[model samples]
Target: MPSIKAALSKPFAKLIAKRIKKWASQPLETQEKVFQNLIKKARKTAFGRDHNFDSIRTYDDFRKNVPIRDYEALRPYVDRVVNGEEDVLWTGKPIYFAKTSGTTSGAKYIPITKESMPTHVNAARNAILMYIYETGNIKFVDGKMIFLQGSPILEEKNGIKLGRLSGIVAHYVPKYLQKNRMPSLETNCIEDWETKVSAIVEETIKEDMTVISGIPSWVQMYFEKLIDKSGKKVGEIFKNFNLFIFGGVNYEPYRAKFENLIGRKVDSIELYPASEGFFAFQDKQDEKGMLLQLNSGIFYEFIEAEHFFEENPERITINDVKVGVNYVMIISTTAGLWAYNIGDTVEFTSLRPYRVIVSGRIKHFISAFGEHVIGKEVEQALREAIANTDITVNEFTVAPQINPSEGLPYHEWFIEFDIEPKDESKLIQKLEASLQKQNSYYFDLIEGKVLKPLVVTKIKKDGFQTYMKSIGKLGGQNKIPRLSNDRKIADTLYKLELTK
Candidate 1:
């Protein structure tokens, strides 16, 4: 693998720098104008021949006329493209397919065209650059960068070979820089996903890694393995690392423990990456929230969270979004996805065109008993409660189950610990009090006597890991469901005896 410096010095980095500079200098109004113009052009190019493109001409038209399309809606198109449909979503040739795990449904094979590859690479590069800009350290020439991603090699099934996003990027790594990089293509290019992640764990300990990037859960698991292999603590191995970039899920639950493990406050960058496209990234280095890429090869739309499911859902444009209000995000991407509801909700941290925070997934909530407990609320309560406690939680999952005695519902928290609490009973009480105080609905559920006090289930060190393994899903790209909004998750957890 190539050295970190060489990888960052590629032509792509130069291109990204230019784009960043250009974006940074533009006025908000100018940026909006540019975004609108790009949207117009993309619409024209995408649908000009059939006149179907004109259907989304106006902001209202785009919102009202275009119905929300989910993964299922686009499944036919994705399947057709994979089956050798030449004129697919993008105008350029499709290099390969990005295999993704669809937990709610089944496995999904997404097409990653040549034109869209630059979007992912650029978004990722900008995310890192933003982190450096925030943390005030740029020259990582000597530090190693570890990416906890899927294996870069393709797996064949039923005569079709599928390469994941990680593999695709690995295949296209510039030849000259591949030698010094710690996780070389040979290490990342394993055909079996499990074997690849295991290899990654084995190789990660031998390198002088300075920047770690991956899903928060997998990185944590890797750290556990490192601790086992080296007989050293997380701080020892990660002390040299300057930053941690995590995405794909909320990192709030793991933040305290992660920082504790690293022994210092490591800079973090979050990204909103999807199989269809890279939607947004953390632009400013110190910013906790992500900035939506407004002028990329995509058009954006938002529906007020309160009215997202009204009979006539009113969609708002970028100019209409207000800071601190949650909205259901929609986008028309280069992948030919129109008004696609990517199952995520976001809130603007700043009124400017680019800044926003990923609130949570639309479906990743518990409202079984009219107590709507969202991920953000849970994260907030946990952070507040932990701030006052000596306990450290590495990972956690929350599910709502029926209370047989009352025939109502109650929430059960499954937490994985790095260190046992000094006073377990007090910790649980404090957590419950914090949750009740922070979330009004949860509070009502408890105070109104509809549900009993929240129960905490402390699991073994590798409880989540064991659960993942039980389901034939362990390591890279596989994560324990953070919020079990549906009955299936609760059922699955019950079957595995991971929950009480």
Candidate 2:
């Protein structure tokens, strides 16, 4: 007998197929009009009344009236909502608060109300659905989807629930998928990531999994465990696995390692989901970037990342964005975030269907000597350096090393290698050269003797994994920042005795 899940997926997939086509062909004007309609509806809420949302008629009016806010600026309102305050930020108290690790400021508690839950749930569903429709691959529904997720057991904070975003998303997983999901709820609630992964490996080693999703690092950990437990390659153990879904970090550095483990290349999807909202996802297999979600309830705005630090910086809307320019993202959503800066930076790869490639975070950069090196530049540098080499860098992080006693300041790279290169010196030289080519300012600083040559530090085996475990940020939706303007994280890693 055919599975009910499989049968139900056929019609749901067909519906998503049609909707994605219509959504892709949707005009910018139509999307803007729909956004305005949403704003009109929100204006009746308490938050709207306080912000004079009723007085807004046009996008221009909305922008002029609402000052762009960072997570810190919105923290006051969020605190109220957490402390049993209703109709403050949203219509009522949030159903849950999506807890996230701090960028630099501190940890955040983002509200997820009844209205906004669907945006999280449907956006994720639609990402896979769109991929299924575009690629004509629906074999996943027939088998199982093993989402490497956080603990579903939520903690209560003054009558309000608090948990990781991935955990909260699991709560809303479709009933049809409940039977096909893995690791068991018992294993998922294990707070320690390593223990949880071990339990998951033990439980799912014999299951026929068709799809898997999580941050590439954690998934890679799981893959290693599976190989250890089964004494077989991933492809051999799970022959039916076809789709790999991932987000929260750059997938380039890990791609080669993944292929080596599986013994073949598999279709994969990339997503841009944050504590703030699910932003975009890779829709078409052939496309260079993920398509932006225009009709999602979130209203989007952008500020040129270069000008973001300037006083009275100009804010640009979705219709005005140009390709290749890095922009800091701001959003106002149904969850009561009004013109909130989410701290991410992205560059549009295509404008026709509005596709974007996440560049880096607003705070994730090294500019100690005014060189302004961002995560995009670092990843590009690594990609170019490893392009022709036999190197497989497992994970890496960059931070500024400034010490007047040490003479000159320079950027330091801490890398964990899965497959070491035959020529380590050659690889380092290539990495430095590529970085200089990517950031002219960094090159200029080197020429002026204001900074030393880039330093490469080989991290201990499983160094990053151990560090993440120590900090309790070890699983889904949590990723180590690739770059930092300061040495806090680097010093901490060094303290863990990881330096080579």
Candidate 3:
């Protein structure tokens, strides 16, 4: 039986699902409309005048007049907004800044406008509603749902608020769902992730928990804590737990470990969200990728990932994109990001309604030896190698061992296993074979004897957690990149393992 709120929300979910299908079916028209509105909004602003947004009549003119820029390139305009200036990037000041850690620039402040803020909340809400419309399971709505995220506490700067995107979103959980949300405000405010997860487990262990949402790695930590305190698997502790919603990182790598912890299968929905905007989410349970949010106050652009580093690479809209090609995603959003490169690479899975799967990051790849192995390829290799085996991997990362102490250098895999496999040598063969299949460059390098067979370095239990803690990025939206071009993290992991 559903609660009164759940009963009412069910029909409304169906209605919105219909509306979503209507727009998703007309990707080009929906995006054109969003593009027009963004240009109209930015025409009077400082960035608009400088970029000549006034004379931009079509995507061609807009692309020519505005150059694609990363966060560092656009920081001059953002510094103005941070210093209490108005109409610098977009119309008026941003309502809030989504703060995230940056490697070179320190903390990055991404603006969230009055127009763009609601889309974040609505997209997250509609993701669940679309799930209900498709599956007809609103029973989860009648029970508690917990979102493991950063502290909701925010800081005021120049009459505007700034905080982690997840924490900023915590303030916008709809009123009707407030009673059903877990981890008391006091509990959420705890700064330390270990303490926060402990408090969350204490609060939710006895409750009728039906839904759990967060990064899978952190959620795994929380689930282990619950099992430790309750003396039962998560499925046994919370009989009604039915849905898992996750984003920020690929969930495939953690799926097997989660199934072991839960002791049963549960439905899952994947989402593609960022501080810039809620870009996409899983609208159909059976789909391979998320439905691109065409009408959500964002205009999308793409450039072939291989050509992205070249000056003036072709930038095309959704109408021109094809399936299965890796492309770097760019956006001109209502939040006033103009031709902004969000640093993510995506591959299209469907062209009719424009569905995409995140392939990798533009900068995060291993090309040290001319074998540009991507995040997707490495993850797929690991996933394939672990299939049907007793291995359940907790976490893993890849880096090129450029200069090894031994023979020829090769790719080094740092894997933390929840259930170690019996045959380790066979596992490496499977992994290397899979990678060679997906990447021709890597294959040539391996076949040519330019590199040795990949090495698998076993990371001690909680080694990743310890590494993250040593660097002050323990949890809460922080994730280790799947691969890197350098040993910044690889060397650190080796040191952590030595101390352990």
Give the best candidate by lDDT: 3
lDDT of 3 at 12: 94
Error of 1 at 289 (Å): 0.7
lDDT of 2 by residue, 160-181 (tens): 8989898998899888779988
The per-residue C-alpha lDDT of model 1 at residue 332 equals: 73
Candidate 1 to truth, TM: 0.87
**Highest TM-score against the true fold, candidate:** 3
- True lDDT of residue 112, candidate 1: 63
Question: lDDT by residue for model 3 over 1-500, one digit each (tens)?
Answer: 66789898879998999999999888888999999999998999999999898899999999889999999999999999999999998999999999999887899999999999999999999999999999988889889999999999999899999999999999999999999998899999999999999989989999999999999989999999998898899999999999999998899989889988999999999999999889899988998999999989999999999898887799999988999999999998988898999999999999877889999998899999989889999999999999988899988889999888889989999999889889999999999999999999999999999999899989889889989889999889999899999988899997766222
RMSD of 1: 3.8
Badly placed stretches (over 4 Å) of model 3 are 498-500
TM-score of each: 0.87, 0.95, 0.99
Query: Candidate 1, which ten residues in sequence have the lowest lDDT sum?
Result: 44-53
Worst 10 residues of 3 by lDDT: 491-500
Which scores greater on TM-score, model 2 or model 3? 3
The local lDDT score (0 to 100) that residue 275 gets in candidate 1 is 74
In model 2, pairs of residues that clash are: none
